[model samples]
Target chain A: MPPAASPVPCKPLFFDLALNHIGFPSLDHKLPVKGAEAASPASAGEANKPDQPGGLSGLVKGLWGWGSKK
Target chain B: MAHNIKNVRIQAAYAELKKLIDQGSYSRIIKTTNKIVNDDQSQPEAWQCKVVAYIQLDQFKEAINAINKAPNRQQMQFELAYSQYRLNKVAAAIDTLDSAPDKDSPRGKELRAQILYRLEQHSECYTVYRELLRTTADDMDMERTTNMAAVQVHRVELGQCPVPS
Candidate 1:
């Protein structure tokens, strides 16, 4: 099977918080790459999340502190 | 909207504590710090959240409910005994340890002795600490094992009386 074409190129952004010390534990514990991967859309059905309050949007918003889009 | 009390800011601490404890990170001990602050966060799961928060901060209470919520047997017994000790209740701590399902586990024995020491039951602590030293069993954490053994010696020696000059 042919692979799907990329819609957009990805890039990583880095922030330098030179003065922060607690950032170490905060980053290590909170940025959950594990849960994010498990919750990928391609593998999970859409309907499954409806029962979960605001659903996936709520989860993502909660995980990364992403506020509701304007 | 009656968004109620399920705000992310409210639960963020709990979510953090759960992850930290699961990974054995940093031992965020908080069981006995702010009793009044906790008695005031009126919300669902408030007590559980308070107990967990306090456990992370090392401000442990009697931990009756906290013990029930412990994710595993060892942690549950440890918290239960520790809470009892904080309340100046030693017999209850011993009872809790005696009833633990895995009494033979070194951590379990360590916990029981720690409780005795907290109760100022130094002789018992000395005896149990000696017993733990003899186990010499293998586990993934050799460093932690050695440290716990050393803690027993440190406590016993510290508890000893000074001779009159």
Candidate 2:
């Protein structure tokens, strides 16, 4: 017999802003098609890191128009 | 009759708005629909079109307000939930979708499952997708497979299921 199904959690999981209507995660970055070769590696590396802002300072930075640093 | 003429005019305006939307003219969609609504607020289709334009322009608050005032709120509940979901109003989105008139609508179910996944309600989300597999037989294999994987991961995370040996 198949394994018993797991129970539903009382609360929901963390949210993902990049998910589309179909339950698939959308690629947040623009694809490198036309100007990919011209792109710098530094920016590409930054794209891979998660978007967690650490604390109050990070939240302030986010609110005050500070972007991700190199 | 004057009413028939007004209906024809509204249809023409809506057709023009639809063309603008297809051309990706979201701003013009708003402008044109604004005129249409000013003339006829009873046209629910115009309200719906304006809501769609606002969403495309990333104006979630405006979209939410528009949906709230829509005459056919039940018909447009999915769009309302979608805007709420985009705004990170997860619980509200779920609630809105729960009240959708078409309870078994595949699109509504699919979006609800996605929101459930975001909330980490993986087991419940997976169950929804599984039910959808039977109701929706087209272009859903990837959705099902990914949701299954998500549920398995969630189960392991919760220690309800062991990791593969």
Candidate 3:
């Protein structure tokens, strides 16, 4: 039987390289909780008052919020 | 905290894949995204990235496989149609969109418009493009304009439109 070709090495996924995409800068950082800021109209004085949802749910919720009126 | 890290990791991985795609490093993208898929096959974005990488590599069969791995097949229909289109399976691409229940979906309609244009169905293609321009996002402006112009030229050549009397 013929020998198979050597498998190519997997390049390490890098953050800076990944951040080259236009959308990634926001994705790399904290995403504000949807509607949290709007729900508290009086919190204009506070610098960071959001009760943010973190991680996948937050991202999904953010995208869902963009897609639908809520 | 755990969920936050997880999402960030996934997003970073996805972003890396997108970057590699933009760099035209399809093989590297496939290798890396396959690792992500192996860790968690449920990530739709990962599967989508893989599908696009495979398409860029002209690996249509693998692109189809990657899309099939996605949880929501309906959501990935546009990508599937695109892979089929690249494979010169235009009718199959049209059928893929047609079979989806959301006939009015912007993605389906836009892709169908492109396919219709490819099939030289200029009138129907133009109507689809116009509807898309009215209904879709601003990002679609370039595509809609290009398709509409192509339709106009095709119509003029066929004597379907008056050349301004």
Candidate 4:
């Protein structure tokens, strides 16, 4: 008579090597335009400061202050 | 300037693909990789990503097809063998692994040991596991030890001594 099959459930250690091998360009570096845009808002905010005593900057600050009061 | 724009577009596409992979969005990976490969058939990484996505989806046949489309079959032998193993094409899987350049790699040995176990070649499996345990560090030796123990149990069940030593 043939022996009974072993009950131990031995299975293959399946894994994908492609996950490690498939290389893609790193996304760590921001695009030049994106970097410029990120800096724009901070500069624009500084320029719109109410303490600035001059032309377009002061005019924009006055409008912003007036709008905030309403 | 044109070349730089094209490079940026390629980088953006890869970034999106990486995000999709991290999220386990296999379907989206397939779609995105398909587009990338269509634009450049020479992109082996795109083919690999598509194959991996198909495997994750349990579509072994599709995975095999994608592997076949890869620019370099030698580099994808492990993937081809793995998909074959999953599909229950055991003999073919062994053949594929045998043809691989790095067939002696740890991963390749592990897969081969598993295949041997499936084929009821317990002694051969035990030898493979033993070699793996010898070469690998203690921390990574757990799986090899467990597999070797299982193989030993089978050997004893077959009325053979667990180990000659």
Best by DockQ: 4
Candidate 1: chain B TM-score against the reference chain B: 0.47
Q: TM-score, each model?
A: 0.39, 0.63, 0.56, 0.67
lDDT of 3 by residue, B71-117 (tens): 85666676677778767798998888777665566666766777887
Q: Which residue pairs overlap in candidate 2's backbone? A: A12-B119, A13-B119, A13-B120
Q: Can you write out model 4's per-residue Cα lDDT over A1-70, one digit (the tens) per residue?
A: 9998788655434333223432333334523444565579887786576555669867887799899999
Give the alpha carbon lDDT tens digit for every residue of A26-62 in model 1: 3233325436755888546664755567776787767
Residue-level lDDT for A50 in candidate 4? 55
- In Å, residue B65's CA in model 2 sits off its true spot by 0.7
Tens-place lDDT digits, model 1, residues B10-113: 34554555565566453342321123124334432334434544554555563466546444435355456556655667788788768867565666666666
In candidate 2, what are the lDDT values of residues B1-165, reduced to their tens digit? 987777667666766776676687988988877877777888776777788778778898998888788776677777788888888899988998898775467777777877887687877887887887777766646656666666677778888678978
Off by over 4 Å in 4: A1-70, B1-8, B138-140, B162-165
DockQ scores for all the models shown? 0.02, 0.02, 0.02, 0.06
C-alpha DockQ for predicted model 2? 0.02
Task: Please identify model 2 stretches exceeding 4 Å from their true place.
Answer: A1-70, B1-11
Lowest-scoring 10 consecutive residues by lDDT in candidate 4 chain B?
B138-147
True contacts kept of 2: 0.00
Q: Cα miss at A28, model 3 (Å)?
A: 7.0
Model 2 lDDT at residue B17: 72
